[model samples]
Target: MEALLLRVVPGLSEEWQGATPDEIERIEQLAGRPLPPFYRWFLSRMGKSMGKLTYPGLDFSASRVLTCYAEKRITPEPRFLFIAYNSDETMPLHVFYDLEAPARADALVTWGDTWGNVLHEGFETLREMLAWGAVLSFRVGKMPQQCEGIITGEPVGFLSRFDSVMSRLGFTQPVPTGPYCRLYERPDAAMVCSSPSAATFKGGQAFTLGGVDEGALRRILGEIATEPSLEVEVDEWMPELG
Candidate 1:
């Protein structure tokens, strides 16, 4: 995990200041449960770093961790510990610690803040979780390089994998209702087309062009891609595709 953090966010190790053993003990006392071994090791290594990675809104400091746990200490079911949160503090990410496991190091299950539904599970250790996050971070452009070519250079397959990783990491956008033409306005002045059938919205770069026929959709997309002054009304009902 530390190695991955260094690779993804360079100079993270130097910036990190781990918590003292006494601080860790105090945190445990407050939480009324022993910290997982992998998590404790993580805290002992880099718990004080203010660096933000993966989730842009979160810091991995011990204080932040303790605060999140305290905030959710009253919630019931699927007992877990909060690890990180989104920018608005609406979503919290957590890890389920198995009390019965040997040293509580058997496996780690992660989840988002959607009523305790599991986001990911069966990670052998916290290191595995970090490793997965590293790959996912790369996919989402949070990390340095483009992960598209790392695995397979094919755009379609790479995009599929990218969406899969985002889903696993609980990065999802609200699906527009009825019919919509989703557009991806690219940096190179190219427009990408996406719809319910296409499902090509990548990394949240899409806007709803609600209820348009194929021709109108193409015209509006082209106008938006090139000229900023053009405006068009979208129909509420989607035309049937032959």
Candidate 2:
């Protein structure tokens, strides 16, 4: 995990300040059980800070998670240990460990929102979730080197439709529906598409393309933006820079 973390976000070590033993103990007591080994290791090593690699919405920090539960802002569930919560409130996405399951080094984790919607179940471990977030942080945090674009037309199914089109373009959906966004990746580049939830009607679909050269980014954008299934105008941000 350490190797993968460093690989995804360079200079992360300098920013990582782990939690103290007392802090970890307090959290464990709150949980009424020991945290999964991998998560405990994470708290002991990087709970204080994860720099840019810390997932945007999920609250993996020991102190924050404890506060959320201790203060009763979000009531804890029976037989379900909450590892991360939607601190950003961009979406209700939260992750938890099933305490009733058999004990192991890592617990079975579920992805869901505060509204009791299980976005995904048991598809990722604590380590894998962190790793995926690292990759996304590394990609999305690339900044002005990337392109931001908006799709015109109806917003419903925009992100899912974008995912479908990108998948056909050789991109794979590594993880689906985290913080109201979906991530698609390929060898040379990665794209993140996000839309307001079906309940919200404020914003349209937007995406960011990074880890690719300007030329390739433009070409790929042209391909997807022109696809008949996604009938929308892509206002590429790459042009103003040139």
Q: Which candidate is the best by TM-score?
A: 2
Residue-pair clashes per prediction, in order, are 0, 0
Query: Which number leads on lDDT?
Result: 2
lDDT of 2: 0.66
| Cα RMSD for predicted model 2 | 7.1
**Mind giving the per-residue lDDT tens digits that candidate 1 earns over 28-58?**
6654676677777877876776344434665
2-110: candidate 2 lDDT, tens digit per residue: 8757766778888888888888988778778867787788888888887766766666787787787777765566666767777665667678776665333665567
Q: Which stretches of candidate 2 lie over 4 Å from their true place?
A: 1-4, 13-25, 28-45, 52-60, 64-137, 140-145, 152-161, 176-179, 198-204, 236-239
User: Relative to the true structure, how large is the alpha-carbon lDDT of every model?
Assistant: 0.43, 0.66
Error of 1 at 100 (Å): 5.3
Task: State the weakest 10-residue window (summed lDDT) of model 1.
Answer: 143-152
